[model samples]
Target chain A: MSELTLRPGRAFSMVERNLLIYRHTWPVLLAEIFEPMMYLLAFGVGIGVLVGNVPGLADTTVSFPRFVAPALLATAAMNGAMNETTFNMYAKLATEKTYQAILTTPMSSRAVALGEVTWALLRGTIVSTTFLVAVSLIGLTGTWTALLVVPAALLIGATFASLGLVVVTLLRSWQDTQLIQLVMLPMFLFSTTFFPLSVYPKPVQWLVEALPLYHSIELVRACFLGTGWRHALIAIAYLVVLGLAALLVAVRRLDRTLRT
Target chain B: MTTAPLIEARDLTKTYVTSEPYTAVKGIDFEVRPGEAFGVLGANGAGKSSTMRMIACVSPVTSGTLRILGMDAARDGERIRARLGVVPQDDTLDTELTVRENLLIYGRYFGIPWKALRERCDQLLAFSRLEDKGSQAVSTLSGGMRRRLTIARALINQPEILLLDEPTTGLDPQARHLLWERLFQLKEDGVTLLLTTHYMDEAEQLCDRLVVMDAGKIVAEGSPADLIERHSTREVLELRFAAHERQLMIDKCAGVTERVEVLPDRLVLYTGDGESTLAAVHALGVRPAGAFVRRSTLEDVFLTLTGRSLVE
Candidate 1:
């Protein structure tokens, strides 16, 4: 393999290429915006009417719509990040051979990995921000601390995006992409994105707590509710470590796969 | 007498360490000088692409030294790559983008300024005869047009050394000729070219100097004319007999030529005077189904060196 060098500038060029493609396919971006909105409408408003307010351990009661809003924000981040790193990355690597073309230039595999993750983070940010605006208009979030969801969603996006890249490198065919939907559906349902962890059995709750999406939901919820700063910091630390570790693995995998 | 070669490889080897370890390129030595059209000629799986990959700085050499433009391939890959234009065996153009957009994005990868890239993109489109299809999607183009666009994309950086791996592998005769003309223009512009191909005609038409590689090693090296002059006879007499009668004919034509290569359906007789050889064979009470005499080509040189045809 050639020397692996990380040039942030070259990574940004990859990001620019994605942006250029997205410019012509703006409808796809619009479609992604609707996924989080529909989730919010179905669970937050439709189901909230029947569930009413949920009790908190600190003698507080949070409305159902507000409770599910932050979890959906984290879900949006995961969906956005995973979609790009899996389908788009796979197409570029296998079908299109775009990564091979890029490698011939000055950009190294490290740059391609970094650039892809960064693009996923940007897409995740877009989805999370739009969801935040829709949720705020529906009177789901009242505190200024909700703004922190942007960075929280970004962290979640980076973590899942890096993991998605690793999965793509291991994948052999389009059929392997089905494995992503399998894992993602479980994470979406069982990670407390639609309901609280208390609804599940203690063993199930423990398993959910170990999930990265569960940590993301915890952090985003704490920010929106303007409470649980201590737990929020823990969630931030967990996501930060996960994102960095996954990024390192992703870069190493891309280097090995693309170079030789 | 001591000027460094533009591209140099000494004892370069590539051993793929997969489940079953395989070595694609054995230790070999070659040099490509500035502004020369150099070629690596070989059949499929002859380590041509592996060698090209190492020189392109995308694949690291398993051992030995490789320098491009006086820079070490392993240490200064980025610097070397910035000045190298590479046309890979397969077309890697972004099918989603327009022909012009493909060139634009490729130029951007080299950090070319937007204004200059736009101008250069136009020049390349014209050079590739793709100006009329500038706004068309790459997927809509024909195989030959796509190939031209790929070559245009590589030249977006105006690279000093252009490495083309089988530039005309799968194209019609007309398209191949047009591509050859364009590549000739690039050579005339004083850009050093290093291309690999199994097509003897392509090598003869485009290359100034070439090496014939068989398996993993360079078997012969010289200009096309020189290689033919040194390794092959002046002309070849091809005689086609029925499948069952080829051996009998070969035995009957003993001592008629310098060498005889028997194929599945024909026999190749290497001799200085093919017409006289054909007449001599006919005088032996053997009449071939078909007979033709032609001057020797690089293919005959490869056959003489490797004991196999170039296409096979």
Candidate 2:
């Protein structure tokens, strides 16, 4: 496939288009905040009562809410970005032909890919910030480094958004969409979100380490607990590399699909 | 108008690399001069949309050359597209947006300023006769209203060349005429128009010049009157008969007219003069059928060139 000669920042045109529609669809934005809050209430509060304090970084145990809060924040970032890229992007690309129409203009496929990822980042930031405020109010902040979660949420969002675009572009039938939920539910439940990696068998531990969500939770969890700087750097590098590769693949695939 | 062509193509081709590779356009050549309405007339799957998509700069040319507005289409697609307005065969309007907002948002894609686009948006709404429907959601609008809105959106950038593919394929006659009037006005204002349609009347009414395409190739090219005069006679005499009598009548009527097209239920006789031809048919002593004479049209030209009717 030929590479597109991308124009810098032209992707913002797509961002503006989404913002225009966002005027009437603010209710969807409201739902993003509450979805994670519901998880926090049930998993962090309800389950935390029985599970008690789990093992934490540096051999120190933290409160149950504090332990689960960062993981939930990372999940929120992933969900926020993935939701925008998967179903909504699919409708625009396959059903509504929005990208097909846009291609007639000066906009290239690269711009569309970058623009959607940027919008997903914005969405991820909004919901994660709200969650951060709620957890901080409940006295979950163990250190000032928890402020780093906002930028970390953006990284997590970007990574998932790019990866989701790659998947959505490859999606051929509506029935295949169930595959996304199948993968997401397992990753969310088993990515050390509610439990530690030590609880899993050695083979399962290696599998969880390979999953993207595990790295995301570890990165965000380190931010709140103020430890694990060396591991955090590795996690950040992993996400950054994965996000760039997915973005490249998404743009090339979109260019082939739209221009063909 | 400048003498130089606004768009030009030489041996342009488009082939799909599917499981079974299919070639949609077969090395055709054409040009659109400034301020003229040029058309490609063909039936479904004759490669008209593929040609339009290539000219619109959204589809890559498989081989050969296409240049729009003096820039190479392959190398300068973005620059050429920036100066062109395209109305695709399907209505790709954002159903989630209001009519005016759709125009505003589309204008932003061209990097138009918000204030200028708002003013232009109002003008476009009035121009397409959708002024009252500006704030309505796109999903609430009727088919004709949506088509007009799509046209309005295409005009947001004040494009020098307008490309429309099947601009009124499925519209009611009244809506089609209304759209024709709007397109005529745009031509009067000097925007070069390139459109494709299977409707011969639409080609005759809007196109200054056109090419007839069949099975990925151009069969004939000329003004509508020129094509009719070149390919068909001055008039056509139609005679309908009982199913069994049609085959017998074809042999009987062969020598009376210049050409005879045997349809399923009717025999279309092409002649220089319909009256003399009908008189000649009567002289043949076969009087057991219905008959009529009419002037030749682009439809007749299409039939003569392609050996098939435009609709089929």
Q: Go through the candidates in order and give each one's DockQ.
A: 0.50, 0.52
Best by lDDT: 2
- Per-residue lDDT, model 2, residue A65, is 80
Residue pairs whose backbone atoms clash in candidate 1: none
Any runs in candidate 1 off by more than 4 Å, and if so which? A1-7, A56-59
Worst 10 residues of 1 chain B by lDDT: B241-250
State each candidate's clash count.
0, 0
Off by over 4 Å in 2: A1-7
Per-residue error (Å), model 2, residue B95: 0.9
Chain B TM-score by candidate, in order shown: 0.98, 0.98
Evaluate residue A182 in candidate 2 and report its C-alpha lDDT on the 0 to 100 scale.
Answer: 100
The ten-residue window of minimal lDDT in model 2 chain B covers B241-250
To one decimal place, how large is model 2's interface RMSD in Å? 5.8
* Model 1 C-alpha lDDT per residue in residues A1-260, reported as the tens digit of each score: 12224345878888878887888897887778888788778988899899888753452488888888898889888888988999989999999999999999988888889889999988888888888887888788889999999998998899899888888889999999998898889889888876777778889888998999999999999999998889899899998888888888888988888888
Mark the 10 consecutive residues where model 2 chain A has the least summed lDDT.
A1-10
Against the hidden true structure, what lDDT does model 1 obtain?
0.88
